[model samples]
Target: MRVTSLLVATGVLLCSAPAAVAGPAVRIHDVQGTTRVSPLVGQRVTGVPGVVTGVRGFGSARGFWFQDPEPDGDPRTSEGLFVFTGEQTPAVAVGDVVAVDGTVTEHYPTAPEETPETTANQSVTQLVDATWQVTGRGAVPAEVVGPDSVPEEHAPLDGNIDKRELEPQRFALDHYESREGMLLRVDDARVVGPTDAYRALWVTSKPGQHANSRGGTTYTGYADPNSGRLKVESLADGPFPAADVGDLLRGSTEGPLDYTSYGGYVLEATRLGEHQPGGLQPESSRPQGEDELAIATYNVENLAPGDDPAKLDRLAEGVVEHLASPDVVALEEVQDNSGPVDDGVVAADETLGELTDAIAAAGGPRYLWRQIDPQDGADGGQPGGNIRVAFLYNPARVSFVDRPGGDATTPVHPVERLGGVGLSASPGRIDPGNEAWRDSRKPLVGEFLFRGRTVLVVANHFGSKGGDQPLHGRFQPPERGSEVQREQQAQAVRAFVDEALAIDERARVVVLGDLNDHGFSPAVQRLTAGGALVPLADSLPPLERYSYVYEGNAQQLDHVLATPSLRADYDVVHVNAEFADQVSDHDPQVARFTVR
Candidate 1:
């Protein structure tokens, strides 16, 4: 928006701002106005008064944030502005008062890596194409964020988030919008989200917002995404601590709040709080009783044979120590022998063999695995990974019904054998041709014998939430586009379960895996439709239910469901999701049932 004169580009008039507006002295609050979007957007302003509060000297988004030292006293309008210099580092330092010349712009940002359609993030109001003159230095004021300021309600305009009036006193999102680019503080913050590879973590300004047992904020529903939850990333040099959930960032974490595509509203902190260990430990589910069969579901994040042997060893220990070596484990994201190398080798025997071998090495039961190799490039994941779902069962505890002729394309159906329910092909795919399973992992159904009773297990890895808009994206409530395919997938799996239970009304069928949707989501609802299966996640305490954490929100993406006929003792083993040095992104869930 640097055009000084009217210019035509591709037969379209491209202009920065009205020259009349450029001459007038407009304050930063006047530019930001009282809305999620700036009212003065696309208009050029001269002498927009503010003091440099924060300077982002690195990255592709180099800029300096300035705030008005004098307050407007309006709760809705923000008194701060971001002078986006693009890749050029800003010349001004913090506390230097400046008068700027720039065009007000609404920057629609995106997450650094949006799993879904690279959706547009909620617009971050910025002053672009700018030049500034240094005035006298001024004090930078930082407002404290707490329950007294931010509201319990998150977004006022749920789906239609942008261009709306900022109700700073009513909604938390609006309150954040009101403080855009301004210095803010979270005091004595509790680390709710574990520290990631990128020196960033999530903390809570308002504690007790569905605070999980282990300090992290629990996302109970779509309505309340925990407005207190704020992502914290340090602007100061030195390494960010490997902070886990339940850890404490004791004391003040002060910084200018900036919105990005990564997490919705981020506090690019100039001062991080003291790191205090919370002593949060990975949990282990109680071992199965002598007559009980324990089943677990874990997504070993894209594990391949060529991956570090330590990774396999870690996963093996998670199976043994964290999940108590369940009798049967349904594993997701098991890659082929050569991980991520596009040579078209689809067999995962070596990959699965290494995992089972590692389990034995870790002093776990001698586990045998069963799986049907999916056709190359058919099931979608990492391009060359060909990740698929497979089962690992302890031979000493349970027996796999190895009916032959199961392949990638052949669908497994329920059959009656010896007056009990069994699968047509023990290790067969379910409805691989369905449109629901297109570019997704097909369901793998297996029949098993536990204490002389027939048991059927259906393992599924649904289409990811990769195509859905983030919660903090432009759209309110966010668009779950991937849910369409996942819902269809749930239906396909539900139909399979229905057929199995139909064959035997009192049959023991366990449906589990990385369903990749919350228990409250439509996909999960459809999977448990008609009461064909009961979701075990729903039965757990809300604070203890989550199996995955993303962007500071502790949520569930993996589940164990069972038919009503089987009594279940279930626990979600908390291992990877809350820890920094995790082998997998997901924590495995184990369910036990007495068969004899």
Candidate 2:
């Protein structure tokens, strides 16, 4: 015990010494001031010293962080710094008080080789080409920082970070950028989102967040309403714990701030505390009406044999438990039996059979399914994954109008039925030959008889907005080039709906699927033109209208629309999207309407 005490005293003595320096020392605060870029960037300096607080020796971000023992007392400046060694593998350890000789750089995480540019959430202040010698070893202090340390005001009113870059002290972007590479801590942070596949978690520091009627943060579409939510990025990947929405990360989470291509400004966490449930419950009571015919749209996210069986089982349970087994289900992204095998096998019987069996086992009626298999590699999703749209209907509640299935090249047209409107080909692909659907999921049109009424259901999965420029890119409110193709697909579906409406003025039509575009986009505009169809999402409160969450912002990408004649009400099911254990990335939407 005496020897141990002596060693502890000696270590503390060595670390407490004024970080022995060989040349002029520069304060970390002066280096990191109230600016998007570092003040002393691009200059080489010696005797820059601090105690190593953290070390990240993983991926492309191999570096160590240090913080001065005492801060400069300037709220607009940070006292911590990160020295990036790249592949050199610096011989340093955490808690080592060391002086570094290196070039100060404002490094952009996306384009690491190039000089820094003022792109939103792209840059980090760091020291590169560094050479450091540990003079002492002991514990280093990491000051706790949380939402209070950040700017109180929300982000810019226009929802663009570029405009607020000039005011680093006031704006959220500038404030977080100014504190880049700092050793920080967040206490009692609430996990607002699920832990994604990349081992990242989004948390909000504020208590009692405005959670939607369903779980997940509500998107008010106002200026930075969720400004307090920050991302927690794990430097050590793999074996990440799965967490649901509204969980609480209680205790001090210490780490160095980092900016990455994914999730922008993140804390590369080193020490994480315990997490507890945030009392988030899945939606239980489904839509109800005595004469209502319920319809639901769900993106199953490439379900196949090789997928996680537990997730698939939960998905089936959600359909029955949360959605109350809607009369008809418009399912998207149903993968082939062998999921991405690249063989010519395009059948999904095994996939659908298992899901149906699970649904039946979960107390739901046996659902009959219909879909046309797409040619291998024709539908764009995972490479070799031939995903397509399909429908699942409870035979007890609704009956499908059986007809011939259309091929990849066959185009189905709308026809005037004896009593109402129907498709020339049930389970037909609309405009399959159009370039707009070259590598995208084509729309599936089908006719259903519901409570003495003929209902036309169009299930579609349009082109995604993946190719669009990122919101944090050089472009503000980034351009969505993919909308053009989706617009064409929308027009085709709209034309078919118009033909159906022409045949019967009171045609009960429901268009539903993962539109892959926002409600206000041009594609939605074309889909709703002529007032023939109206998005049911508009009926929801703007704050609760979202069906998807990306970068902490809740927005709608999945939609359900109804013709004016259809007396329908919809609810965005909270079974997925907000939780990590979900079977799909999107929330399922269910609408109940009285038959015409």
Candidate 3:
């Protein structure tokens, strides 16, 4: 329950506004205004009457929310406002009716890690320099708004934030934006995602959604405008337990509407109802098969030397304890030894060595590693952090075939193996010079021998969706321009898979990595064209197929795709993605193949 310091000291100058004085009386709706930007912004107003709904003391923006007992009659304007009282506690409490005075301010509460280009300004509208006089104390009544009006339909298909801001009711984000600084409620809320480290919950009241075969929501190409999923921010200070996907928030959730840079519109909730677990567990059982050679793909999330030793320990334990120490592991985001220092150092042997030692400490067998270091700055990731894909094989269970011509720029081709085809370059890069891989992590191809069977593995870390617009941006659905690069990368990988299969029709080939796109995306379609190769995740139950959750949708970005001839059972380990206290941002995946 460690609250950040910056949020605790945000409004000193604003709260210090010239000693409280009698000011003009105004309605809550008047202060709310009818547009995205409040009309009364920067003006000091007083004598605003309302009932105290809740008090928040955790973060930097300490304050209490009040709701006008009487309606403003205009559906576009909200009848509630948050009066910033800073880190100090307020005299008023929930359920107390009072009259308050404060300066209207529109401010953006951006997190420190945000870049200048991505940091949105003036996103949240609030009341500052507040002073309130309590008149009476009584029970507060809750509003049941859901099923009928909790979430409005339609997001602009065209990518235009201006149109959304101009017409607040026309888009989903605009509709929520219009109700900024208001006490809102949602009834019959079902948890769409787990509670994160920030104690935020994502829920939706919509009955019909594009659910996976397992009843969990899937990322169906575009962000669904019709889905009623919304983020609920917990303002209280306490230990928040994780909720399962599809769990229910019994009764309702009530809070003041607030806008944040991460998830645009959210309800800073004063009250969240009971949680019912949907039988979701924190850890996934190891995949089983006697003749099976277990394989896993994990994006260690930029693991490098000289970083937090505890994080490296946890990641190693996750690989052994949670993933059951697969025979072969395809790891992404393996950074250089010096980490994010711009020293032009491009070796990762020490980085891999520490991880191997930790794995042995965690009771897992010592794993042999292989990878080719890319030219400095050639791989895209944290600047000075040259992240690349690597492999870790248990020498006891499998053997890495040593071949020639393995380097960063060399393209590995299929060669003859024992009754099958293996990679000509034992460990080499795939299409490094292709424009698609520029400033992105190139795919690492490795050849391994398991039980007299040759398994060709291509580990990849494709271009991310960083260039895509935000889901709540002006553009309704938000354009995914990064898909173009990923599609090209997929096509290149698919071509290699096709070549391997052509050399030997029964070639056992597995492609794994952080595709950085959904299973239903165009890139996936390109990779699995003609059913030559199939996503192993498709073989699992819909509810159990996801390896990543973004904006409340449980979907697979980390995939394990194998040729049609390979028999395998895939499991997206439920170890990291669901918990905020995770070693990595992604969930690792394990697939057991019956190769003999």
Candidate 4:
């Protein structure tokens, strides 16, 4: 779940109903006034009735979620109702006008801004606990209409509204924001794409699974909101109709609707139009056996697997498209664990086999991974999981060569001592005096024969927390000196590169990873010698050299640097910053290099 700034400041407090008898119901006016003033926390007040504005089945079986507008009439303040386990009550359809008597609770609000006003008013509000019992039901409400009827001014306001009314608008706006300026839609209508119809199926299987599960599957299709041409995977019994570039669809609004499958990869129906021409496909295709290949990298923000395998299946499509498409893909934030039980599964069985399978299904090649073993005795977030780096290569274009010390089957070297100090002895707050630090994976390096030439690829995910802080930096620095640890990681990579240079003068190297430091940092300078790796496009300006765009500023934290010889064959055709919504925090950076 995305955490907004406001939610972060006030810890989400939960108030439970009284045993058996249920808590007393309180008027909305009473709670609203107190919540606004002191924000009562963990208080169990009950009995408030409001129109059922919206209802949705949570991606998992966790239960249904409904939203109700403030009874006092302020749309800004809405209650997000979660009917969790044991509340297997009837499903609430959209617009089903029902009065519910239940507890008032606060979900984790995202972090609030550090401004003086917000910081000073960070008191949390508690909800009254009353067993929500549905009183009555009726046809979906009209005021809670679909996306087409929602005004732009009311888009971000969260209340229970007609699912039909809100969905299309939300879908359209999100798509518009995601695809701004890159492509245009025809007739501004909707049509189906390859993956749209199959979203429900995908979500049911993998709401938030890890990237390594092989059993995981994904579907791709599109939808035409205006024309009501919604094509989803299950909607059509088979393959979807072929669509070429520039096909225009008609008759759709921007709203959230479930497009089920019709026969032969067709959409059953569409409620709203997210954008024109339904779904998006790459306009340009890579020619088969082309002399050149495109290499890309992305962080795939929080691509970790949930405790359940089902959540992972839901997210397969986004992960596959974002991180697994390139000829040589490097991934950061990958987890490795060793123990009897992991995420409720056997340790030996928890590898990301599902993700690898999803990539192969998408016509991408298979992946091979290397990770550090967690220490025997360690205490932290989740035991047995280690964050490391891995690679997925197209076997047709690349072959692995065994180094004398590091064979094909051998694992990458473990930098037990970071920046010339042991993990326990490191001067950082996060891991200070932690002996199990070696168990934390550092960098994974390998030799790949790309286009008949050997290229050394090093993939790393550096320390993010525990960095030094500047007094006024927009984002607070890590308390443990994350800045220092990151520098040590950089030095480690450089050391690896220097070793490679000694092995073969003509050895081509490409350093691809999430370094945590931007392209302009002193650490990067120490590694690349002020653009010595040779900037791909001198004509493109420095601002465009970034792989991640955040807060209106472009930061080149994810990078692809090549040795001097390898630099001659490739030109930075273009880098993709578009997959921020579907896949990760960092967009994939793709560079096209002609085989010399």
lDDT for each residue of candidate 2 in 173-199, tens digit (9 for 90 to 100): 556665666777888777777889878
- Models sorted by TM-score, best on top: 1, 2, 3, 4
Candidates' C-alpha lDDT: 0.85, 0.75, 0.77, 0.38
lDDT tens digits, residues 1-596, model 3? 11121212432211134465566899888887776557787788887988888888766667788888887677777777787766765656788887777888766555242332354333556777676667677644655557555445556565444323344445566567666666788876777767777678788756456665433566654645345667887876765557756677787688878777666677777778777666655575574555788999999998999879998899888889888989999999999989999899999999999999999998998999999999999999999989999999999988999888999888888977666797778898887888989999989998888888788899999899886766765455666789999999999999889888899988888999999988889999999989988888888665466777777777778999999878887778777766545778799988899985
Q: What is the C-alpha RMSD of each candidate to the true structure, in Å?
A: 5.4, 5.4, 5.7, 14.5
TM-score of each: 0.94, 0.86, 0.82, 0.44
lDDT string for model 4 (338-402, tens) is 42234432122244565666666665567544333333323122344444456666677666544
Give the lowest summed-lDDT range of ten residues in model 2. 1-10
How does residue 450 of candidate 1 score in lDDT?
88
lDDT over C-alpha atoms for residue 591 of model 1: 94
- Look at candidate 4 and tell me the lDDT of residue 592: 54
Best by lDDT: 1
Worst 10 residues of 4 by lDDT: 216-225
- Local accuracy of candidate 1 as per-residue lDDT tens digits, 130-184: 7666756787769998767789887765566677877888878888899999999
User: Model 1: residues >4 Å from true position, as ranges?
Assistant: 1-22, 111-118
For residue 503, what is the lDDT in candidate 4?
55
RMSD (Cα, Å) of model 1: 5.4
